[model samples]
Target: MHVLWRGDTLQRLRLVSGLILFTFAATHFINHSLGLISVDWMHEMQKWRWVVTRSWPGTIVLLAALLTHASLGLYKLAGRATLRLPRWELVQILLGISIPFLLLPHIINTRIAHVFFNVNDIYVYELAKLWPASAIIQSLLLVIVWVHGCMGIHFWMRLYPAYRRIFPLLLTLAVIIPLSALGGFAVAGSNVAAAIEIPSVFANLKVLTRWPDAAASESLAWLRNLARIEFGAVLAVIFGCIAWTYFARVAGPKVTVAYTSGPTVRVPQGPTLLEISRMSRVPHASVCGGRARCSTCRVRIERGSYGLPPPVFPEVVTLGSIGAPPNVRLACQIRPEHYLIVTRLLKSETAGPEDIAIEEADSAGVEKTLAVMFVDLRDFTRLSEKRLPFDVVYVLNEFFGVVGAAITEHGGWIDKFLGDGLLAVFGQRDGVEAGCRQALRTARDVDLALDHINAKLEAELGRPLAVGIGIDAGPLLVGRIGYGESVDFTVIGNPVNVASRLESLTKERDVQLIMSRGVVRMTGWIPPAALTDQVSVRGVAEPVGIIMVKRGRELPADVLALRAEEKEKEKPAAWTAGFWGRR
Candidate 1:
């Protein structure tokens, strides 16, 4: 049997199933908490059970879905070549194993008993006995199962840009939900115990008072039988869906396509080239599934660009940001409208550190470039340590927001955030003069923001904050770099490094902003008072000229006068020394 291994599709299935299971488990926990209110509330849950199970078709569908999900999970586990999995994977496996064991007995005791023995007193008798003794076990199963499923969903959602911001919030909710459910369960258990002691009170409950007589009515019996049949049909439909998807994958048409480097043969009409590549035994990287959220699967259309559809929205956004060639596309987003030839740019199955780092090096080798800016936060480590985790996060967000806004406003793109620093490139999208002016304007804006941030923090935390910035202009290499699974577009070479180093010197020089002579010469917009001679840097053999910038909406007249007076005093001292020597 030719088993089609649609890894991407299978991953997506796992994501969907995991999300469904998580949502269901969350609701189940909340329902269990209702037990805290009173046994009647718990007993009321049976009504919904009937609704969920009333359609035989729905029950059958759920049963099949559960079975297929479990089977696929097992298949994935067994197919793994390496025993060394990630810590999260191990956690998932352990939880997966425990769930069925804990849940199976509960399912058999309730659903199976009702189906075969006509025993419907699940809420009153069975749950009371099992829950008290196995409360810890049940809670454990609930936590593990829900967490496992939630983690899977979180992993999948990380692949999309829109969902990235919500990832942490979703994870936080996952933890909060289980705790709330457990609290409710405790309350319900106590209520159930109390009600059990008062038989008179319990007998008056609606479910018991309206108990169905076994031989009472043919209509009631017919309804019960119909409900069971409907439940079975539900299960059947779910099974059919899984079966159809599997058959479709296996029976799909196969095609051979030539890659720039080689050839791969696989089922045609896949949602992505990565899917086809994986099935064909061609090595490919999909760090974030095939969502086109990450550029790990970037490939150039060598000879068959016309055979593919125009780039999708995601592909266009990601590729455009990274300045990819018009023919370049993400393998995960490209579906073959026709036979095609492609060349993978990044040549590794896993993302490596060199992917981003090497790209910077490559960009620095370019001939003519625009502007580069380096921003370093002042005393970030000290500030971070003084604050709580949440506070630190808030502060960093604020800092990044301000700097990012400035960069983007001036038509520049951020290369990367280096801990407490920021590196940005200008001119690749526009022209050289525009890039230079943008960098300068961004520096001035940053100074303005720092004043505002410091004022706010001073009021809130009784402290001030500062940052130092540097701008430089030069020719450098700029391009994307990475092997198969990881890649980024960044600037590289000495100019980029020097810009960073210049920012570092600002603290000792007492300058809020500094620009290299290269920038002043290229832009020809240097202020006369701001210009300074070559200053010694740590590494380079020669000194580099710079322009020191002071904060303030405009340079203070008094501060300028003080500088002039100091220069005058120095000249008088030199003259007096010369006169004394002559005498």
Candidate 2:
């Protein structure tokens, strides 16, 4: 069989059809609102509405739009791999698909009654035939159609920059429009009820009903029966589609999609990555709910790209408009055929207790330019031997907090907690220059925090403690290394190893902080006073030049000073005679 429409064409057609339907509903509501003035005025306004919507051309548009919209909606619903969606999206779907079934009875009693029973398709005819029940039922149909149309508008306009600003005004209209129609409808029903008690009003209503007494009751019963059958059949088809969706999930081939945060979810091959996230109860952000209308559900593919299909036209247009990276694609559009690994591009969007805990993606072997800082306690081993094990643990915990605050305060993220030391990286969010500067500032502050910790301990144990800090900057691999839920996000490279050696050198050199010339150069800052020397680092034969920064010197660099309170902190001056003599 030949397909008549492409997905893109169908999408546009759905929009056109929905707009057509909304227009009809709006006019019908306006006619109902006229009942607030008088029932006769309501009928008069409806005559104009009938010309606009119930005439030959209008009827064609209305019927064609209804069939097209409902069919396309059901087709899309069946094609969706997973039904897990945001509450609003689910509500819109439920209400829209319910339109055919819910309005069947109203459709029969009016249009069918007029055809078979010779009743006028007007207010007085409705009063004579169905009376009170018709008003309430038609109002229910109006609400469902209005809400469904409003939801369509919301999904289309939410990504526009101005939508958020105008949301309140739009929401008020959404509520008031349907409510006014219902209120006016109730008033018209009351008028009809009052007319039943008055002879003149009843005489006027009798002219509208042309139902033949002999056939009227039989025709009305047949109409109600046909409506009930249509309603039941539509429900069965909808429920069957839902059942098929469930069975497809259960019986389809499954593929693994691994997240950088150590979650490996197995999902059926047909669903988009966003659908898999939803099916697995992973909170993925989809502001437009997988229709590719919003790019909130973007992901950066880390591995297995060869197994995925090329971007379709819709995905291409959306990604191009946003200027997304080549590796990044909307999760809602990507349907993977094989194993894959990915990281969420926008972690903040899925930030809630129910959402999957998203942290920094581990860059296994990917190289990055970063500044590494290593801080180690000089006398921790001897102190741990002297103190009780419980006390040692307590003291180490306290020390971790102090050093952690200092590193974090200077914009460095802790990479790992060593036995008596910690390794940190800077410039992950910024660049190498800023990272190097943050490492320098952190080294100084950690020295100060160490001093404070030592002062408190000195009063308790009559001995002060000391710490050594080393800073180095270079390209290194930064990512998760462990497996089976024991993953660790860390950095490893010559620079990291060199920094550790320098930290060890502080104990021998008896200085508070040691840094390589590489760190200083990376920071792009000229220092006032600093001790300089060549020290052999492990795994390297040639000695690397190092700079030992002293206390009370200013760091006069733009990269370091930007949004940081570390300008007055360090001054690196060349090591004069006997720089290590005091220690």
Candidate 3:
């Protein structure tokens, strides 16, 4: 009971064991690929590999990992309150369970025969036996094992910040290794078949003496049959445990789960809210497939919240990172032991792979000094009042296109579009200093882009387009917020609100851009004393320090020139701080 309940430790052990087994499988496939050159090459590589893997210590470690991983996997599955899972998770599980059945027979014939019956079990001998008869099964074993290992690796690796950058290379190797191994096996098998046709080669091969005697061959057969029976018994016991757990949960007690969305379901006790939602066919978001890495599956307990167990470590980390309130809990982590009314925080239909693909800086969430920018086109509404609806929409899309491009180009993401305005946040992945510098440059680019747009629309429009830009930099609580389809990954704090106020102030102040003093300072630039002012901002108790620019294009020439010189001085230190140093 103690061992089973320590889920975090068991999960870590399972990951370690899985990685060890994956390494072995990868190396074995690489050895098999050597057969592409010649069967002798395969044997040569195998001999080198055997130095570690075929040794007593290596064998013991390999067997231990195999047992640990298999048992842990079975236990994890049996512990699941519901069999319903994401498509990829279900596929990985099915493939993992299928591996032992296909693999045990092969292991018995080769490793067992080598140790007990003194069979050579060399590539040529085995290939000759396997060529046309056992080829399909061996191929299946190779693919199933590789895919299962790769999926497990994917599930684990995707949680990291660097996984996305290295994924393409990983995917290529995954595909190439298995195909090369299968190709090598086919070529080697053909060579063996050809050699066997020659009387001299066949005699030298000693195909009949591969097994010591008829008795040894009969004994190998009996061992394989017994191994199959033993494996079957183990599987049967695992399934029996799962079935007993399910039936016991059903018969022992029942609870009513009332969803705020108006569905009240009577589900058996034991399943988590997520499992219950799936069982009841309710729409609930789970971007990390119930792993608790993403808090998209969070639900607010509307009623019956008392007596609930505390969140586990993973859930605590995720919820704390996102700054979730006290009443909210991860649906995937908590089992409703009693009747409870809950509301899903995110819409399942709107959640996608991208929802879990958080950036390096925004893994869950935390406080970071970031540059927040707000851009709004001035008087586009009045311009649209006289123009055709089609023309208005067309020009608006074009306006947004340039704005979006400039935002992304300057290392920020457009958090959301506000009809004629948009919010962009920087330093989410890059640092605050870079974000401030980039925001200044983005303002300049937007001003330039508008000029080009105005030139193109000169005949259609009586006047040129105009825009206001605002930038602020400070510590902000950055994370995903909102419910259902309206969920947004955004920053919230004084800085964000200040930026919005500054953008609106641009119209009254008659300027193209307005930036907080902190933003200018973060960029390593001192604003001109004459251009700076202390002004009262709506909703803010104190006056805010700001630097205004009448025209963005003129401002960057002075600001970026000073920055360029500073960056030149930094080149030496920057070179020392390469990819890893950036972190």
Residue 359's lDDT in candidate 3 = 26
What's the candidate order when arranged by decreasing TM-score?
3, 2, 1
> With candidate 3 superimposed using the best TM-score fit, by how many Å does residue 397's alpha carbon deviate from the native?
8.9
Residue 501 lDDT in candidate 2 = 90
Winner on lDDT between 1 and 3 is: 3
Q: Residue 486 error for model 1, in Å?
A: 13
Give the root-mean-square deviation of each candidate in angstroms.
17.8, 12.6, 7.6
For candidate 1, the per-residue lDDT at 578 reads 20
Top lDDT prediction, candidate number: 3
lDDT for each residue of candidate 3 in 172-205, tens digit (9 for 90 to 100): 9999999999998888988888888898888777
Against the reference, the lDDT scores of all candidates come to 0.63, 0.71, 0.79
Query: Residue 576 of model 3: what lDDT?
Result: 17
lDDT of 2 at 449: 74
Candidate 3's error at 334, in angstroms?
A: 2.6
Best by TM-score: 3
Candidate 2, which segments miss by more than 4 Å at Cα? 1-7, 115-117, 127-131, 209-217, 348-583
CA deviation > 4 Å runs, candidate 3: 1-7, 207-209, 212-215, 218-252, 261-263, 285-298, 311-328, 343-365, 369-371, 380-413, 416-420, 426-465, 472-475, 480-489, 493-498, 501-583
Which prediction has more favorable TM-score, 1 or 3?
3
